[model samples]
Target: MRSAAADRGAVHRPPCRADAGPDDLETDVEEIQNSVYWHDTEPVEVGEPLDGDASCDICIVGGGYTGLWAAHFLAEAEPSARIRVLESHTVGSGASTANGGFVGLTAGKVLRRLLWYYGREKAAGVYRTGARSIIDIGRFCRRYDIDADFAMNGMLQVVTDRKQLARLELQVKRSERTGLRGSFKLMGRDEAQERIGSPQVLGALRTTGALVNPHRLVQGLARVVRGQGVDIHEHTPAVDVRRVGNGYRVSTPTGTVTANEVVLATNAWQHSFGQTHTKVMPVWNYLMVTEPLTDAQLDRVNWPGREGVSNSLSFAHAARLTSDNRVVWSGGRWYYFDGRDTGRGHIRNAAAFRDLRESFARFFPAWDDVRFSHAFGGPIGWSRTFIPQFGRLADGVVYGHGYTGNGLAPSHTGGKILRDLVLRRETEYTELAFVTVNQPTFAKGAIGDTGAHLFVWRQETGDRLPLMLPHQAALAPRAFFAGRAARKARAADTGR
Candidate 1:
């Protein structure tokens, strides 16, 4: 599963001077490879593209984690059913391989909003389901012998400033009050420093989480799906999807796939389809991976557990160590292009790379001498509610998108929900909090683009000037109610 192409022909350069300011490091982006580090770790053997029209019992678009997981689950549940997955690019080349690989609760970040809108019981149910999904993914990897470097190391939600500490403490309290007493452990400055060794971290909330080589996990899952008699056609994009005689016909560049049931598993690209165009906004996020740390450099930090760490800001920064010991840092301000553009032309944002490098150095001064070997960006499908949505478009079509940049574990949960929907079964997955007939959507056209920019500005401003502004929690109610109003408006128009 290794190839010479994995090298990417990247030329390493000398590390930026430790004394160099953030502005000085911005010009050093050329030293990094404009590629995904995870993808370069292994070779992906793409399946042949479809040369002719095809028909199957189930047709799945987008061969990322969600689509592959759905195929794997459906094949096991209905061994004789025909399943086909259509991928626009090579499998797992989308956000699945572009993320920081911090597998944690999907709704954990929005727990307060969930409690405000969906009651404590339902919020807890979503949180519990997320916790179980993490374990289930580990089991799935072992069951299929997929060596994805899965580790159940907990995650740290550390606060970098005093203003953020109170919000972190509130989250811990809410978790306990929601019947998850032992799920989150609040750590003071000393305890938090022991795990992260960052002077800026005043406190943290350590919670159940895991890490994985997302590329390996997704590629191995695709292999398992293929072994189970599921057809995966790579480099085959779904051009359009239309209804046809109680089924759906998905048009592709190579051919067409008419199936009795269709699963729209394309996350960020879901906006390209009319059925889901307004349902999600594709926002670009960037990441930079440092060259492997030397033993001496590793000793400079006290992170023996190698836990994934993230800050408490609205546009937070997250850092995690890869299996090979490289630090992958991500998260800053997210960008939304006009006209909902998600093309590859936007993958190399100089500003985002600069922000990531600066933040990484600030978080771990010990790594200031380490140079980045890779830098890249990808779009994440964001729903207005900051959670995933699962439901049927028509009797013959179903979709599971809107993970809101936290899809690794929840996509597994989404697979089960899609499975039950495709099989027409009333199971627990279909009854979860995110599974609804209608979810909130973003505004369309120029207004939508303006709103997206305004949201990003607010997040960045809050993180930049925490003391000068109110806590993000204070603004949560207004955002939540705005989403509620949008949902009601959508429901009214659709008469659902």
Candidate 2:
């Protein structure tokens, strides 16, 4: 499922560095803190941890969006089915609450790859399904009165260099050739700045998507599930899961649960299962939020449409305006611990946040004076093929994960797929390409670590390669310096 075209690299111009004083780049705002900003305004009541032994018709291992959505749809379809969700932490404590909250398509070269693999029609069908998921999520929020601060403001994939324009053009042509004409439109410098006033943005591709308060969305789903008689237990990690005489037994520290069916919705933590070790790798990403902007300050930018903006580079920088007018900025630096470890210690990377803060300054020079109110992050599941994995495992153990960094909308679609699988029904969702694909896994031990490192290096290098060889020749020295910085950053990531 690897993309030779994508691997060959896209030519993009080198990004221009913004001129700023040392003070401007590194603010004296002592209030810079660490917390999930989305949860600060919307606090959710945490459910009690799993108690002593229990049994149900179905037991879900994770209480995040994937599990909650599965519970929601399955409960709606089968009212009498007993469902229980077990969480190691709170419902929204994982990537559900900590992500950038962009409910966009997972068509990051997916359409192109699918076209090469399955041709235009099947690729179009899968791409359309992914797009529909975003719209359906908005409808779900409205019908249930779940105020997740969801806004259908679309998204912008902007490019700062001329080399990057070629990449955007390729994407646009692929979209048009695959019957997604109006869905993706290329915007020049002037048109892009009109949507978001940023000096670094030279061009952009506009696409439909929604921004959400991920914390509120997940909490609202949990409440709805609980109201529908679904038992959800927090702090109840599944220590072991094995097949019983006719069903499965899930053992926890406090007790055990026996169920006719089991679901492993744990994303990054799927390492608990030996089968998922190479199927997914947990990568840490950081995010930061600025204090609320004054009305006068907000007037400086012409982002009245409030579109979620991200650069076209790999491991791109992303930004969106919150309900309170604060800026949620993320990306630029990502970390992968040895042996694919995932825990609380991996959440705080001061160097990563520092790099993000500097990027924020470069993107929005006018906001240099604004101080960040919160900075926090968590791990996301990354598969070798860069596509999410969804299918049934042995012993009636169903699962959906490996969303890489894009899971918000896809999780909803995944819920539908899991529901069909649970009922043993052959529906449209169950027939999608994502459900029937054979995804490869990474190697074990040092080879695996080196492979992951090389992947990151390729993405960074491919992103920096200028389309014209002359430009690449001119920036050869700069590339050497960039490589050194990347090595130093990786060495500093002790995952302590």
- lDDT winner: 1
Most TM-score-accurate candidate? 1
The 10-residue segment of model 2 with minimum total lDDT is 10-19
How many pairs of residues collide in each model?
0, 3
Off by over 4 Å in 2: 1-31, 468-496
Task: Give a tens-digit lDDT track for model 1, residues 1-496.
Answer: 1222335664545533433575676667755577777887777777899889999999999899999989988999999999999999989889888899989885456788787788788788788899999999999999999999999998898887766765664676678678886687666677779999988887777889999999999999998999999999999999999998888899998999999999999999998898898889999999888777788888998898899999888788898998878888898889989999999977788889887877877888877677677789989999888888888884457998988888999999889989998999998888888785348898889999999999998877877674645654334533432443465478568976
lDDT of 1: 0.84
Cα lDDT of model 2 by residue, 237-344, tens digit:
898988899899999988999999898888888877765667777888999877678888788888979999998777888999988787899987568888877878
Local accuracy by lDDT, each model: 0.84, 0.79
